[model samples]
Target: MIDEVMFMRHGRTAFNLQRRLQGQIDIPLDIVGQWQVDMSGFTLAQRFYWAKVSNIARHPDRLSQPSDPPIRRSDITEYEQAPASRRRMVVVSSDLFRAQQTAHAFADPLGLDVTLDSRLRERDFGQWEGMSREEINERYPEGYASWKAHEGGEAAYGVESRPDLGKRGSSTIRSYCDDPQYMDEPTTLFVVSHGSWIAATIGNLMGLPDSQLDNLTGMRNAFWSRMEPQYTSNSVLFHLTEYDKGPDVADAVDWENGPAYLRNPDMPMWKPLI
Candidate 1:
């Protein structure tokens, strides 16, 4: 029962810095990107560690012995010493170099291996793969205009359509969750993929209409979104619980108190950041 899926966008690349369409170009992360990965990775690992502790604290009956002492700071070290299987988490990534690099940042600290899936690759930009948005607009005014209007004009230029990209991305994620190996446990899947692909997949998972797709904006580099399954009578649907979260937000959390602190009934619930 894959409990949750964390879809993370890879770190910035040279092409990202230059505002060019990388598509499937296999770009590597730049210096800033590496730093982003390092910080976010550390924060991610810390959050996971604390989340495990929180679960134990919430369900003490699950402890090996009823007389076991309350969770303490030393539990962190104990967790690190535990076998990887005890973590109940898996890291997955697009086969692209950038995505794989980002995935490793989270996997290495968590002592998990990354499972690569080529289907998670970024949408093929085709003729505009290496071009900047400005160049595309300048070179193919009509197509660019049509694309901006959400009229599927880019298909004429050999670009992958949004529907096609969404299908590919959503199906790839579904396959992983449906795998027999992951179906029985409360596992968390960390999927590192591309910006466009992530957005499209999320939109599909949430069953967003084409006219409503634009309501969900693109994700920034090194940021992530968390989704949990919401089982309906007909099928299971993923609900977007968090979006565009990153190290900055994680750093702001009150780690000493844990995530539950944020759910205090007296605490004012804030709207999601733009």
Candidate 2:
């Protein structure tokens, strides 16, 4: 059975709308970001039914292990089929307002509660916390220069280095994924973190170094990716990956700001849960 833990990027943030760093800052979602969450919720909800049915068929007998679920059939629903559903997918995010807000979009569809993890927080930018990229470039040119190049173990504005951020991000994932309860489920984990942390964690997972930071931010929000198994929970990360830019949907805020599913008129509280 494929129970994949997935991530959904929160829509544009107030900082994003304003083009600010937003590092470790608390900011809510903009109109477009709210829309992204609704869309992610719908996509995941639709995909959930089929994935559930397939898992029941493939892993007819419970394996009792957390390793990747093997493919029982190849000619299924193409790539988004059998093997995909075998892994338990969990959606998580950095504690930043934007990241948690974005994470809710995915959890909404799965009927799961998100854990607002602080260790998953974006790199603490210290002095550069709220400045826009342009402001940094025009104001603190030297620090910006070092920031864009020199990394990790060296403090930039007391900001976290690439390695430090990577370590933290990885640590957060390991802390939970290693938990007996979570691993027993064999989930495909999704983390809704920010650009800098995303870059470092993904970069290190893919074996790219500081020179490849540019490749990390290029990934779009509401987008999804995957990684091959790393053998152990601590080391297994973003290996073989897949990304979807996400679908389009009507803009909905009252639904996006918090758990509207609990109050959705068409939804019966005990129906899905029971």
Candidate with best TM-score: 1
Per-residue lDDT tens digits of candidate 2, residues 1-274? Answer: 1134344555666566556777777888766567666677677667664434444345544323345668354343443355655455555677778888777766654445576777777778877778877788788787777666653322646777777677676666556655677655465566787666665666665667656654565345555555544455335544645554455432333322324533446432211111
Error of 2 at 160 (Å): 1.4
Give the C-alpha lDDT of model 2: 0.59
Q: For candidate 1, report its TM-score.
A: 0.77
Per-prediction TM-score = 0.77, 0.67
lDDT of predicted model 1: 0.78
Which lDDT tens digits does candidate 1 get at residues 14-103? 787677899999999876567667677888988876444433444444345434567442344444444532447778899999999999
In the predicted model 1, the residue pairs found to clash are 1-183
Model 1, residue 89: distance off in Å is 0.5
